[model samples]
Target chain A: MEVVNRYVATRHHVEGAPTEADFEVREETLRWAPDSGEVLVRNLYVSIDPYQLNRMKRSSASHLAVDGVLPGQRITSYAAGEVVASACAEYAAGDVVAGVLGWEEYTLFKPSPGVLMSKVDAGGGFPLSHHMSVLGTSGMTAYAGLFEVCKPVKKGEKVFVSAASGSVGNLVGQFAKLAGCYVVGCAGTTAKVDLLTDKLGFDAAFNYKEEPDLKSALARHFPDGIDICFENVGGEMLEAALANMSVHGRVALSGAIAEYTGEGRRAVPDLLEMIYKRITVRGFFAWDFLPRFAEFGVVVGGWVRDGKVKVVEDVSHGLDSVPAAFAALFRGQNVGKKLVKLA
Target chain B: MEVVNRYVATRHHVEGAPTEADFEVREETLRWAPDSGEVLVRNLYVSIDPYQLNRMKRSSASHLAVDGVLPGQRITSYAAGEVVASACAEYAAGDVVAGVLGWEEYTLFKPSPGVLMSKVDAGGGFPLSHHMSVLGTSGMTAYAGLFEVCKPVKKGEKVFVSAASGSVGNLVGQFAKLAGCYVVGCAGTTAKVDLLTDKLGFDAAFNYKEEPDLKSALARHFPDGIDICFENVGGEMLEAALANMSVHGRVALSGAIAEYTGEGRRAVPDLLEMIYKRITVRGFFAWDFLPRFAEFGVVVGGWVRDGKVKVVEDVSHGLDSVPAAFAALFRGQNVGKKLVKLA
Candidate 1:
């Protein structure tokens, strides 16, 4: 069987903030054979993430962790799709699956033990888009980074989340609240900030753009000092958080969207302050906690079903919108988990 | 009892690199009474450390961790002394003790549960100067920072030490070697570098001053990447180490002597690299491990006795040498532990 696949590819290496001009829709032909032991997937919902910007660059430290995206190459992302055809016994036609797919109409995979792809449980009563958002890498990252890396050691611990309205940050704020923490978050826009405090159960929220000095802003919000900082937007925000951290504070580096765009300066925290405070800063990814993915799914899935955790998603239509959807993430235009849905 | 106490004190707030001119020797008459419940001690050996520079500054983050040093006031330091008179039952005349004594000829303290002072076991079979060096805070800081903070998880893990010939750095190199780690260290001078490899059992040592680019130097030395970085000299050293760290690397911020004296730029580590490599950077002081002081004393004391770890001490004579001895630390003029043996 052969199919025409339309995918979004970078027009050139994205060195700075991403725009629609930096990406293009590319065409490809994918062939599958019955005895090939491969699975063919019809992509449904593909994730638009900030971290992808790093991979699009010509050279980046991020390339060491995730495969770099070459110019005009198919972009791989955390996506949900339907297995339209399969030669592998583990997957059959009409089965839904989610893991690493592409920002294209279709994806072909040869299933193996090392494959990130996993069959989405059909019996799970939730929207397919949730698998691309809350039940996906965003949820996994938020869970692992908050619970495992920066665990709230005490009840009512002050938890500060940067880029709080972003995919993982929103979930982190909600999770921190559930763990009995005094959670405060910061976003770029007033609307996003309102969404955090009013809709997302954040104790308080602020527009980072309005603050002249991030350090003073954090000091004002967290008078007692931040106990656990879930760092998503790095650079100045990280520097500010480090300055206002409590003794033995834990900072979980989830993402650094600010630095990825090259628009913000890299954080240069006072090393002496870190020593005086005994701060522990750790960098981690959702894959680091892959063994606990299923465990997280059950707990987070239940929260979504019971309305204990609200899932906020902003999705664009068709593969052609992939460029705009991804570009919007860098601008902080997306209110929540940004996604690109197939036509 | 009446005694004239002469001590070294800062003439003014030291905001930059310290010089002998920044300090002065002042005399004061102290009258001790039995009803005062104060234990009077005649200072013997006093510790001159790099962190004290921060305390002498008008304002610094170090003030949060340690008591700030006011101009013309006696600066408290880690010292060993002989009790002259005691109104507290725990101490008596001729009893040797060590802890938070002053950089003066005499010190008076009211013994309480919160007092840092501890009686020195004369039968411990070490010189009194050793109490201010290996068996004191320097040894404790090295033990806690290496074995506790940046613990070598596996045998033969690559360990990198900066400011390798300093009091704590020297001990960390020796300890890392004993822990079965492949250790490399960087120092400012060729002599200090030679001491690391030739005398300290380090696998490799280099003069950081000779290297034009620290990142390239570290890459050449740690081709396999550093697993544990015992950072004493921060700034460029920290940034270089982060760039060349292995997956899940641990960095224990024991000291940042480079930045403390305003001689080096603040390290601005790539946040993306930290996340990609899953690095853990922690800042800590020896006081954080005060609970295990006795435990560390037993273990480290055994190593020093068995010749498994070498004790290095650099002592200056008289209270008048305090300023010069303290200033020498910033210039890297002293080897091993810098101390002032009072006359």
Candidate 2:
């Protein structure tokens, strides 16, 4: 049978702060019959990530910057969906799965054996979109990036998070607080700052836009020194964190959305200080910790059920609004898990 | 009775590159009588280190850069000496001791209990000056920085060392070579590069000053990827190393003499690359590994004895030449360990 699929695709290549005009929504028809070892899924929700902006650009560096989605092609992202038809023994009709899928209402995925298609267990009692939010890749990023990479955030250590209102940063702050750490976060707007402190339970929050000097701003908040820095916004913010870090501090280079457009200025650190202070700075990708997802789910799901993790979503409705919501991410307008619902 | 004492003192504060005139040789008389729990030593040698320039600076940063020697006070340095008088019963005349002492010929050390003064066990069959060179702080630095900080240099992995002709770098390259790694190093001069490959047993050596593009120079040498970088001369060399580092690569930042003067332009690294490549860039002080000094002494001592480790020292005679020899360190003119010999 043939089905009409509505999806959003990039209209043209974008540079520097992607706008809604960079995308065009259209309808397409696809004949759906699952091939061998394949499945047909109706995507319930699609994730809008900072990394998507990188995929739309051309570069030859050894960066995680994937090839950009070209004109007339539907973009790819981590998505949560319900399987409509299946040829693979691993999946059946109506099974909920979260993995790589296109930004379309329906997808026919001939996934390689044991890659990108995992049938998520459904007893969590949360909405399916939460799979794309806290229970999915973003949550794994916060879990692995915090516990595995940045030395697990010692109790009573001062922790600092840049872009603390974003999907990954918010969870990092919560996880750190759970570890009994003194947590401070920085955001771009006052409302986001309030969300971090009032709603999110950060020990302190500051609006980076209001602070004229980031170094002093970090110093003012982190008087004892930052024991762990969950670095998301790169450039000047990262440098300020480096300068204010305590002896034997650890910095997890989680993301650099500030320079995803390749147009932002980066901070230069005094490499000498790295030795004198004996700091360990490491950068990692979330997939490195995929094997531990089952291990992560057990702990994080309990937190969610116990109401320890306050889940937030800045989701928009319909396929037509995907571009606008995605654009809002770079503008720092999203409160939490930025997604698009297309049920 | 008073003994005439000669020492070197900073004439004035040095801002950038230290010149010969920034220091002066002066004479003083010390009425030395070992009081209760006090010991006196006749200085034999004084080590000239890059960190001394930091001491000459006027700042209160938590760097190795300490308060510069005031205009009139004799400089403080790590020294090896012969005990001339003792009231502490821990030492007697002719016993050799090495620790942080004065640059003056005689130092009356009322050592607080068990700190700062320790007798050296002789019979290593090396000269007394060797205590200030391969057997002293410099050797410990190379050993600890390589073994402890840079992931212990696995066999056959490609290792690169910057400032490969200097006191610490030379030893690091040798240690990596002994561990059966493909070691490459960068030096400022052709003579130093040749010394690294020929005398120090490096696999390949490049003159960074001769190369127009350090990144390409490193890429040519590291066609596969660099697993470890023993960074000493920071700035552009460090950046090039960072660009070429492989996944999970560990960079041990031992020193940054390039910026010791607080004036040299250092090449700032792209903090984002640390994440993309999963690199661990750490800076550490050699003293952090002091507990392992005995373990280090056993291995490095054997290397020096069996002609496995080549010991080199550039020494100037008399206290009058101390300022000139010490100033030459910033100029990158010294080979191996630089020291001043005082009788």
Candidate 3:
């Protein structure tokens, strides 16, 4: 089988704040043979994530963990799709799957033990879009960071989440609340703040842009001190959070979107505070907990069914909108998990 | 009974690099009565540590964990002494004790269950100075930080210790070596570097003062990347270590001597590096593991007796030299554990 695949590619390495002009639609032919041991996928919905910006950079520390995205190359991404043709026994025509697909209309994937792709049920009652949003990398990141990295959380403990309206942050706030914690989140806009408190069930939400001194802002919010901080923004926010953390506080260093674009100041947390409070700051990835995916799925799936977790997603249309959707993340324009649905 | 007690006191709150002029030997009257339930002791050796500088500061985060040193007041410290008179049932005249004494000629103590004081055998076959050096807080800190915080360390794992000639750092390097690790350490001078490589059994040693770029220096020594870092010096040294760490690296944030005096630049580690490496940075105090102190003592004591570890002690004479001895720590003048023996 052969098909023309149109994918979004960076025209050049993005070193600063990315714009839609940095990306272009490039087309290539993808082929699959009967004995090639590969599956041909027609991508339905591709995930637009903030981490991709780091991969698109000219050089970055992110390259140490994941492969860098080269200019004019088909960027590998997490997406949901249907099997158009199969050269392997595990996947067949019309079977729905999710994992490491790409930003193209079609992806030729080789079946291997280490491959992230997995067959998801199409008749599972939940929309296929849920597989790309609430049950995807965003949910996995939240569950792994909260349950695995920051464990033994007691009920009524204060939990603070930065970038609370964003993909991973929103889910983290929801999960913390479900775990019987007092959740507080900070976002850039008034609408996102309202979305967090009114819709997402965050106990409190505030606009970070209005606060000049982040340290004082955190102190005002957490008078008793934050026991667990789901850190995503990083930079001065991380510094402020550390300053107001309680003794034996735990910080899951999930992401640093503030420092990713090279504009924000790097955080200089008080090392004395860390030692005096005996805090533990651990950095991890969602994939680090991939071995327990089914276990996490069983738990999170119940939340979605019981209406305990409200799925928040902002979707754009077509491969050409990938640049705008991605650039919107850095601008804080996306309300939740940003996804691009193919036309 | 009443006697005049001469003790070292800070002249004023010190906010910068301290000098001998910052301290004075103040005399006060001490009274011990049979009805008062107190014990009188003649002070011998008192520990002089770098952490005292923070206690002398007008205000600091250190005050959160330990009490601050008020100007012109008796500064409570770690010391060893011989009992002169006893009104308490737990002690008797002529008994040797080591624990929370002070830098004074004589101390009047009321023995309480929560008090840190402990009776030591005068004929224990080790000098009293050893109690203040290797068997004191320094040994406990090294043991807890290396074994407890950075745990499950495999044999042949590379370990890097900063401030390698200092009290805790020296012991950490030695303990890591005994744990079957390939250890490398950095110190301020060539003499200290030689002590690490020659006297201490470090696989390699370097004068960090001579290296223009700490990141490159670490990379050159640990081409395969550092698995464990026993960080003592913070600021730029910490930033560099994070940059060159291996996947799943562990950093025990024991102390930050560099930032104590507020002279050094604050460390701003690249968050991307920390996240991509899946590192764990934990801050701890020896007192946090006080419950296991005796357990650590048994293991470390065996190593000491078998000559698997070396005890380094640098002592000054009398309470008059307390100021110089404490100030010399920031100047990197002390060889190992700095102490002051009262006359």
Candidate 4:
């Protein structure tokens, strides 16, 4: 059968800031074929993230591992899709699966060693988009950073999150609150600040743009000093967080979207504070916690079902909008999970 | 018996920089009385350190846990002394002990719980002053920061040290070399740079003063980037170190003399780099590694005896010069371990 696959493509090198010129939508023809170990999937939803921007950059370390896209190469992302055909014993036609699928209407998948693809429970109350979002990398990132890395969140322990209204930060704040810790966060705008404090149940939130001094702003909100910091924005926000961290505090480094674009490095605060205060700053990737994925899903899925955890999604329709949705993450346009719908 | 003892006292708070005005010598009358577990000792050598300056500050977190001097309380420090009188079973007359003793000719030690004192090995070949220098807190700080915290220093890894000619930095450089790692270090002066490269056997050494661009200097010296950094001088040095750190690098936070007494905090490079690079930054105190002191002593003592590890001493004679000797650390004076001899 002939398949008309619409996919987002990286058209050219991104200069100062990414614009529409950097990405394009193109039509592709695909033959519906499933080899012995392959499956054909009709795309459902795709995850859009700030990390994808780093992937687009020429000098990024992430790009070093994977070949940089030439003009008209299909943009790749974590996507959830329904299997239309399968010769693989693990899956059959009409089976729902989630893995790294490109921004396309139809994708051909061949089982390679170590490639992750799992069947989704369609009976679950959550939408299929949730598979690529709250139950996906974003949710896992928040879980690993907050619960695993920044462990033993005691009551009244103060926690701070930068990019607090974004996909990962939103869940991190809620998780901290659920653990009975006092959570404070920083976002770019007052609307995000309000959303963090009011909607996300954060103890305090600030618009970093409005705050003249970030260190003073943190001191004002957390008089006792922060016990844990979930760092997202790297440069100035990370410095402020480190400055305001209390004795024996922990900083869980998840992302630094600010510095991913090869900008000249910013100044770091006196790390001697880390020595005097006995801080433990550790960097972790969510994929490292793959062994705990099933365990994490059980806990977070239950929280969502019980309304103890809220899943926020900023979803755009059509595979053509994948580039815009991914770019929106860097611009802070998305309040929570940024996703693109293919069907 | 009447005993007249000379003790160093803080005359007045030093403004801007420390000087002889920061201290004064005074004679105090002592009663020849010994309680059940108390001992009267004559101090022979005292440790003058960069951390002492932090204690001199009015309200620093590094200040003494007990009430700080009222400008007249005798300056306190860790000292190696010979016991003249004792009522404790563990210590007696003529016994050599190392503990927190005042910077004075004589001190009364009331042996409380957890107060440690052991007879010095006269056959150890090294001078008793070695206990106050390499075999004491300074040496232990290096051992702990290198082996304990920045562990698994595999052969062929690159190690970077700031303040490479200082007490702790000097030892760390030697230890990293012995571990078969390519060690590079930065010092303040050309003389220290010579000491690091020529005497201490660092693979690469640079005078940070001459190189205004620390990042470029580091990139030039360590093209592969540093696997471990024994951070002593914090601020811009730390920023440079972070910018040049390899993936999975470990930073052992030891001291930050650069910003110990300052109006503003030091600028740190992007900490998010830690996240992307998956670096591990840990702050540690030497006291925490006291349990492994004997094990460390055996290895280091053997290295020293074989002449594989060289110990450099910047000894300043006379108790009266204690203040000046300590102030030298902040100014990056005295290659190797800085000590004050008072007999």
Largest DockQ belongs to which candidate?
1
lDDT of 1 by residue, B231-306 (tens): 9989989999999999999999988998998877889999999999999999998878888998998998999999
Q: Mind sharing the TM-score for model 3?
A: 0.98
A87-124 in candidate 1: lDDT tens per residue?
98899999999988899999999988777988898799
lDDT of 4: 0.80
Candidate 3: residue B270 lDDT (0-100): 88
Give the CAPRI class of candidate 4.
acceptable
Write the residue-wise lDDT of candidate 3 on A41-123 in tens digits: 99999999998989999899889988999999999999999999998999999999999989999999997877798888766
Report the C-alpha lDDT of model 4 over B1-343, residue by residue, as the tens digit.
4478998887765434577667888999866665546788888888887777666667665642334555777877778889888878777799888878878888887787566555677778888888876788888999999999898457898899999988899999998899898889888888888988888899989888899798899999889888898999887788788888887888888988777767334745554457667777887888878899898878888898899889898888887888788767667778888778888
Worst 10-residue lDDT window, candidate 1 chain B: B108-117
Q: How good is the docking of model 4, as DockQ?
A: 0.46
Ten-residue stretch with the least lDDT total in model 3 chain A: A117-126
Going through the candidates in order, state the TM-score of chain A alone for each one. Answer: 0.99, 0.95, 0.99, 0.94
Ranking by TM-score: 1, 3, 2, 4
In candidate 2 the C-alpha lDDT for residue B199 amounts to 84
Ranking by DockQ: 1, 3, 2, 4
| Model 3 per-residue lDDT tens digits across residues B240-262 | 99888899999999999998988
RMSD per model, one decimal: 1.3, 2.5, 1.4, 3.7
Candidate 2: where is the Cα deviation over 4 Å? A1-7, A26-35, A60-72, A111-114, A152-154, B31-33, B60-68, B112-117
> Relative to the unseen true structure, what is the C-alpha lDDT of residue B21 in candidate 3, on a scale of 0 to 100?
94
Off by over 4 Å in 1: none
